[model samples]
Each structure stands twice: as structure tokens, then as C-alpha cells.
Target: MLAKIEELLEQAKLAIDSATSVEVLYEAKVKFLGKQGSFSHLLKEMGKLTPDDRKTIGKRANEVRDILEGKYAVRENLLKDQELNSQLEAQKIDVTLPGVAPERGVLHPLWRVTKEMCEIFSRLGFSVRTGPHIEKDFYNFDALNIPPDHASRDLQDTFYINDGVDRKPGDFSPWLLRTHTSPVQIRSMLTEKPPLRIVSPGGVYRSDSDMSHAPHFHQVEGLLIDQDVSMADLKGTLGFFAREFFGSEVEVRLRPSYFPFVEPGAELDASCPFCKSKGCGMCKGSGWIELGGCGMVHPLVFKQVEMEYPKWNGFAFGMGVDRMAVVKYGVSHIGLLTENDLRFLGQFRP
Candidate 1:
């Protein structure tokens, strides 16, 4: 029985050493140490022997079993280490290879135009200002002289959040995503005294989306408040913008237009760069391209903010940054600016 136990131990040790993988080593271990295995069979046979012989056989069998278990554990761990090392060698990273070039990203068209517009205003002594996208109806509409059921309020086509504040259905309060940056004009007027000249640039939302319109777009609204601001000043300011933006040679004109927020408002136009007033596909046979809207601040707007001092007056102008960028960059569709197509966007190097 002692010789048999010794033989089994030698066979198991040989198999453990010769085994190419941990799986094979585990199977070999089970053959010797399992419940219906060699060691267990040896112990069962021990009961047939004399009590003294049984003690000798049982002790030898247990010793061999314990030794085999300990060796199997060591072999399994060593096999694991061997596999890890082999994987490490196979999947080695070559540090000597040339580094991949980091991809460069260009500014989005709207942002580019916004930056350019800000720079243009900055040159004219106007500081850049920003305000929240979410705003009260008073600042967005009422303070801008837009009445409750007026065309401008409906014209905004706004997006309002449901805060569950007590109000009738369809009777939304001041809370809404700002449809325009004109609200910043009220914010500025309320907070700061006159001689305020600022260009507010930010995201504005409307419940509108199409080929040329996005639900969320950008606008740079310029305000110049001081004594004796007029329509001519507004025209002059916008003309400067057009000239600086397009070229010193570009001509600008203002056609009479209306906004409920701005009394006697007009849409500014600039000659098409491509056709140069000779009529082209860009201009649709008209020499001019509609750029933006500008007008003197309405008296009701100042009254809404409770600015009683009549000496302060101003001209406010708003131009869609995306629209200007489209015209400037010769982008045919507004969707291209928002669409993150690598092939389409990669063309705008600057």
C-alpha cells in the first residue's frame, strides 16, 4: 500500500510537471484527488485490512493526498503566471513607433461669426456681455415692449418650461428659454446706469427648425445707450459692421421693417459679395442681402424697466450669428453649421 501511494504521487508529479496548461494540470489533479478518484479508492480499501495495517495505509494515503493538493495549488498559480507572461509578450506595445498626430478641430461657423462680431464691436468701444439662456417673460418680452398677446410675443415662438407654478393652461409666466438676446438689454438697463454700450452674444431658442432655421441658434445683440441715440446711429453702427465683416468696399442699406420691441425698426442689407450688385444666384437677382434688424429702443421698453429719466436713449440691433456666418462663409444651408459631419466641418480650417 505504501509503494502504491508513492507510485500515485510520482505519476501526479510527473503529469503536473509535463502539463502544458493549467486546465490539463487540474484534470490530472482530479484523477488522483477526486471523491471517486485513486486516493479515495485507496482509503475505501483500507477498511478491509487489519486495524494496524488500516492505520498505516490511511495515514500514508492522507499524506499523499495533502501533498498532491498543495502541489496542485502551486502548479495552478505558476500556470496562471506563465499564461499572463505569454499574453504580455504577445500583446507588447512598441514604444519606438512614431506617435499618431492629434486631430485638430476648427471653430464652428456660428462661434467663428460670433467671435468676429464681438471683435468688430470691441473695436468700436463696446464690451462683450453674456446672459442666461433661460429668462423671465418680462425681460424677454414685456421689458422689450412686447405686450401679452402682441405679434412679437407670438413671433418669438418660444419654448416655456413647466415649473408647476399656479397659472392657467396657456397662461405661462416669465419663465421660458429666451427666444432672443434682447432680454440682456433689459438686464443691462436695470443693473447699470446710462452710457452703456454692450454686445450680448449667446444661445437663443425658438420652437422652429427647418433648412435655414434651427430650434437653437446664436445672436449678437448690440446696444448703445446714451443721450440722443437715433436710427441713423443704428444704421451707421450696422454699416460699420457690414463693411468690417465683408470688406471696406461693401455697401449697406436699411429697408423699413418693424419689430414690436423696436419702434420704426428696419432690416439692414448689404450688397452680395459674389455678384457685387450685378445680380447673382446668391442675391436672387437683388443686389442686397438681408442681414439683420436694427431700431431705436422703444419708450415702452424703458418704461417697463421703470427707467423714468427721459435723457437716456439707445439703439438696439440684433443679427443671427449663424445667418451672418452662412452669408460670410458662403454656406448654402444652416443645417451644415449644426451638423457634426467630419467631412463637411473639416473644410472650415479657421
Candidate 2:
């Protein structure tokens, strides 16, 4: 038995050393150390030996098993390392090749205009503010002094969201896609204190569409509140914005208008930058492009917001970003801004 054990161990060492791969090493291990192999067979035959012979065979068997295990482990580790190196060599990457160029993307025209407007207002001491695109009825309309039955709330004009449960026509927090960014002003007023100067820019929704109007569009609304704010302050701020944005030579005017949220709302128009205030087809020969609306914050709005009326007088304005982009760049069709045409947007890059 002792002789047989030594012979098997020698065979195992030679097999393990000659193995060139992990699979070959694994086969050698199974043949020598497996349950049905010669080593295990030797253990089963131990009962036939005399005590003295049994002790001698056992000692030799242990010595042979230890040598076989050490050789198997060493060869297994070497073969595994060689296999890993071979795989890595086959998968090596060449860093000298010319890189593939990724298609470049630029900001959308509407976003570009919105960013430019916000940046201009930011330089004028206004911080940007935003609210949920899904707003409550109170903030979007009620808080802005629009009553429930107001023309703006008609289904043909507003985008009201239906609650999953039975609900009233106008619950306390009835959800709807905000019609304008003015609701953000109400939200800011509710949480923030007076002396607020903020510009809200985000996507708005209405039930309208045309060459100049889309069901979805972007707007940037400005709000400024202080102790001594007036219509003149409104004019100066918007006038500066118009000159900086359109051109230093462009003129701005505020004609009498009506908005439920503004005490004396006025339509804001800028002298055509394209025609330089001269008759042009772009401006429909009027020499003026309608910009947006602006006015003193209505007293009812302050009352709804719980801000002391007359004590905190401020002005608010909202401009359509689509229209601004058209006016700024002389876009003939509003739909071009949203058509995902890279050519139209590429013109506005930087």
C-alpha cells in the first residue's frame, strides 16, 4: 500500500506539472483526488493491514497526499494566470486609432430665448423661480384674481386635470397644467416674504394652436415687489430688457390692455428690430411686434396672497418665448421652433 501510494503521488506530480490549461489541471485533480480514484481506494483497503503495517501505510499515504495537493494547487494557479493573460492579450484596445465623432447638439430655440431673457433679468437683480408644471386651481387662477367662471377657465382655453376620484368643478387644490408662469409668483409670495424680485421661466399649456400659437409653449414671467414700486419702475425695467434683448436702438411701448391679475395691464410691444421700426412684412407693416403684457400687481392679487396692499407695490410681466425667438431671429413661422429641425436650431447656437 505504501509503495502504491508513492507511485500514485509521483504520477499526480508529473500530470499536474505538464498541464498547460486550467481544464487540464482540473482533470488531473479529479483523477488523483476524486472519491473513486486510487487515493480513496487505498483508504478502503486499510482494514486488511496488520496494526504495524497499517501505521506505516497511513504515514506514507499522508506524506504522498500532501505533496500531490501542493503540486495541484501550484499548477492550477499557474494555468489560470496564463489563461487570463491570453484572454487579455486577445482583447487589447488600440489607443492610436482616430476617435469616432459624436453628433453635436445645441439648445432648442425656445430654451435659448428663455435662457437669454432670464440671464438679462438676472443681471437686473432678479432671481429665477419655478413651480410645478401641475399646479392647483387656486394658484393658477384664483390667487391671481381670476374667478371660477372667468373666460380663461373655460374648457376651450384651459387644460384642467381630472382627479382619479369624484371631485367638484373647482376643489381647493384642483390640479391643472398651469396656463402661465404667474402661478409661480403666487407660490413665491405664499412661501417667501416681500421685497421679492424673481423671474419664473417654464413651459405653459393652453388649448390653442396655430402658426403663431401652440397647445404647448414656454414663457418667462417677471415679478418685482418693494415698498415704492410703480408703473414707471415697470416701464424702466422692461424698457431696459427690451433694449438689451432686441437691440439698443429698439423702442418699447405699453398700450392700455386688460388682464385680470394686473390693475392696469398694458400690451408690451417693441419696435421691429428687423425693419428698424419702419414698415415691414414681418411686423405686418405696423413697425411694432407685440412682445407681451405687463402691469402693476392687482390689489386683489395681493389681498389673495395676504400681502398688505399698497404697502408692497410691484409689477409683473410675462412674455411668450416662441414669439420672442421669432421676433429676435426673424423666424417666419412659429412651428419651425418646435419642429425638431436641426437646421433652424443650428442658427441660434451660441
Leading candidate by lDDT: 2
lDDT of 1 by residue, 170-272 (tens): 5776689998998888898899888989999999999877666789998999998888878778878888989999998898898888888677888889999
Q: Estimate each model's TM-score.
A: 0.71, 0.70
The numbered model that scores best in TM-score is 1
Report every candidate's CA lDDT.
0.85, 0.89
Which lDDT tens digits does candidate 2 get at residues 233-265?
999999999999988998889999999999899
List runs of model 1 lying over 4 Å from the truth. 1-99, 152-156
